[model samples]
Target: MTVKGVDVASYQPTDYSTKGLDFVFIKITEGRTYTNPKWVDQRQTARDADLVTGFYHFVRPGSMTAQADYFMSRINLVKGDMLALDWEDTGVSNAEKDSFIKYVQKKRPHTRVLLYCSRDFWLNRDTTSFAGDGLWIAYHNGKPGEPGIKHPWRFHQYKTTPMDTNTGRFDDKAALREWARSKTP
Candidate 1:
C-alpha cells in the first residue's frame, strides 16, 4: 500500500493539478536567503485540492542550525505538513545535511523531517544513515518506490513524468495522513 506524490519547485506552475496525488512537497526556501517565488500558490493549489502538503529547503554549504532556523522561519508550518531537506547541492556535506535535519527535529518536536538525495550521494557519500523521519530517495527509473538502496526509505521520487512523481511507503492516504501527524518513520 502506497500513496502517489509529487515534489514541485519554482519552475512548476501554480495551478498544479492534484487529481490522483495524495501529497505534495513544494520547494519553500533555498539556502538562507532565497524563497521559492511560487511556493505560496503551489501550497494553496495543494490545499485547495485537499492533498497533504509538504515543504522542503534546498540545502547549501552553510551552518545547518541557521539554515534550519531560516527554513522554519519562512514557512507557515503546521504540525501535519511534512518537512524535507533537499541535499542535491555538491557543496552540502553529509554532516551538514544530518545536522540540519537534526536541528529541525530538535526545534520542532513531534514533526516529520525527511532527507531527499540522489542514489549516488546515499551510497557513496553518506557516512551516517541519519535521515530524520525517513529518506526520500531520488532515483528515477521505470519503477517507483524502488530506490535500489537498502536504506529503510519512506519515499521515492521515481521520475519527472512532467512532474516529479513519487511513491510513499504507506497503506493509503489515511495512513499517510495519520503518520504525517505523528511524524513517525
Candidate 2:
C-alpha cells in the first residue's frame, strides 16, 4: 500500500524527512485564535518538507464572508492546493454557508475546497447545496472497510495512530488521495 502523507501542526517537526510524506494539511487557526505557538516558528514547515502542503480552518459557522475575510488575512495560500473548511456543529445559517463558499471562491479562484466532518456529522448535515464540492471526510478506525456515508467523499481520514498531535495518525492518505483524484472534477 502506498502511503501518501500526514497532517501536522506548528509544534511538530517542520522538516519532512522524518515522515517522508507526499502531502500535508496544516492548521492555520480556529475562530479568533490566530496564534498557534507551534506554527509560529515553522510557518514553512510543510514547504521545507517538500510536501504538497495545504491549509484548513476550524470554522464555527458564522458570517461566511467575515470568516472568509478572517482566513484570507492570515493565510498566504500556496497555489495548487486545497483550502479546507473544517465544519463543526456551530448552528450556521444556510445563507451564511452559501456566502462563505462564494466569497472564498471569489477570493481564491484556483483553490479547491474540502468540506471536512465526521461520519455522524455528515449524516446529520443539510449540505444538499454543498454537494459536488470536494470532501475530506474524517472517520477514524484501526483498519479499512467500505466507509459508510450517503454522500461521496473526496478523501477519508481513516486509520489513526497515537502519534498525532492535532488529530490521529491517518495511515490512509495515499488511498484517500487516489480515491479523491479518481472521483473529483
Candidate 3:
C-alpha cells in the first residue's frame, strides 16, 4: 500500500483545508529556535479535515533536549500518531544525534519516533543503523516535483491543494482517506 501524507509548515500550505489529506506531519519546532508560524492553524486544519496528524521537530544536536521538550509542550498530541525528528548535518555530532534519538524513543515509547532524511543521509552515513526503528525517506525525481517526498518513500506527500489559495474547495478527501486506511495499522 502507498502511504499518503502532507508535510506542512507556516508558508507552504497556509489556510488550506486538508480535507483529502490522510496523514499530516506538521512542523512543531526546529531545534530550540524555530517554530512554524501557522503551526496552530495547521494542526486545527488537519483535525477539522479529520486527518490523522503527527508533529515533527527538526533536530539540532546542540539543543536536542530543549527541542524535544519544546515539541512536547507545543503540539497537541492527542490526535497525533507519532513524534518525528528531522535532522540535517549542520555541525551536529554523531554522538549528539544518537543521544537525541535514543531519548525520544525512550520517552515516547507508545508513539513511534521516526527519522526523516534524504537518501544521501541514509546511504552515506550511519542512519541505517537507526532504521531498525523506522525511517521516512525523502527522494524526489519529478520535473515539477511533488509536495512531499518523492519516489521511494515510507511516506509520500503525493498531492497538495492550497487551503487558503483555493476558493475554499477541495476534491480529494475520500481518495486520501481510503489510501490512508490501507497503509495504517
Candidate 4:
C-alpha cells in the first residue's frame, strides 16, 4: 500500500493539515540566510494531526558547509525525523550537491537524508553522483512510479497543482514508522 503525504513551504501553508495525510515535509531553511517564518507553527500543527514530520532545505549556489550549517541551526530534529535537500537548480553542480549532503550528514549523523529532485531534472542533469540515504523523486505526471529513475525512491511527489501529493513506497504506515525508527539515532 502507498501512504499519502504532503510537503509544505511557507507559501503553501493554507489548510496544510487535511485528513488522511500520513506525513509532512516542511521547508525549514533556504540557502544560508532564510528560514521559513511559519515552519514552527506548521510543524506543530502537523504533529498535532499525528503526522510524521520531516524538514527540507532549499540549496543555494554557495558554500555547501555554510548552507548545511544554516539548515542545522534553524530546526531541532528528533529521532525518526527525516531531512531532505531540495535540489532543482541547474546552476548548482553535482560536486556541490555531494558536498552539501555530506556536510549535513556529518552534522546529523543518524538522521535520514533524502534527495528531492524531479525525475526530468535528475535525468537531464546527470545527477547520479548526488548521494543520500534515499530518493524523493518528484514526477508531476499524476502517476505512481517513475519509469526510468535509476535509483530506488522512498517517496514520489506525483502531483502539485491543488496540493503537493506524495506516496510513500512502503507496505504500510507501520513499515514507514519502522524505517524512520531504524534511521534515527
lDDT of 1 by residue, 52-118 (tens): 8889999889788878888899877776898999999888887788889988988877789999998
Worst 10 residues of 1 by lDDT: 176-185
Tell me, by TM-score, which candidate is best: 1
lDDT of 2 at 157: 67
The whole-model lDDT of each prediction reads 0.89, 0.58, 0.58, 0.83
State in Å the error of residue 68, model 3. Answer: 1.4
C-alpha positional error of residue 15 in candidate 3 after TM-score superposition, expressed in Å: 2.3
Which runs in model 1 stand beyond 4 Å of their true positions? none
How much does each candidate deviate from the true structure in C-alpha RMSD?
Answer: 1.4, 4.8, 6.3, 1.6
Q: What TM-score does each of the candidates earn? A: 0.96, 0.73, 0.72, 0.93
Q: Give lDDT for model 4.
A: 0.83
If the candidates were sorted by their lDDT against the true structure, best first, what order would they fall in? 1, 4, 3, 2
| Local accuracy of candidate 4 as per-residue lDDT tens digits, 1-185 | 88889999998874575598888899999888899988998898887887777899999898888889989888888877889999988777888888888778778888888888888877788445465888888988888665357677899999997878898988877788778768643
| Candidate No. with top lDDT | 1
TM-score of candidate 2 on Cα atoms, chains taken together:
0.73
Give the alpha carbon lDDT tens digit for every residue of 62-136 in model 2. Answer: 566666777767866655556777676557654555566667767777666666666766676655547325666
Q: Which pairs clash in the backbone of model 4?
A: none
> In candidate 1, residue 10 scores what lDDT?
91
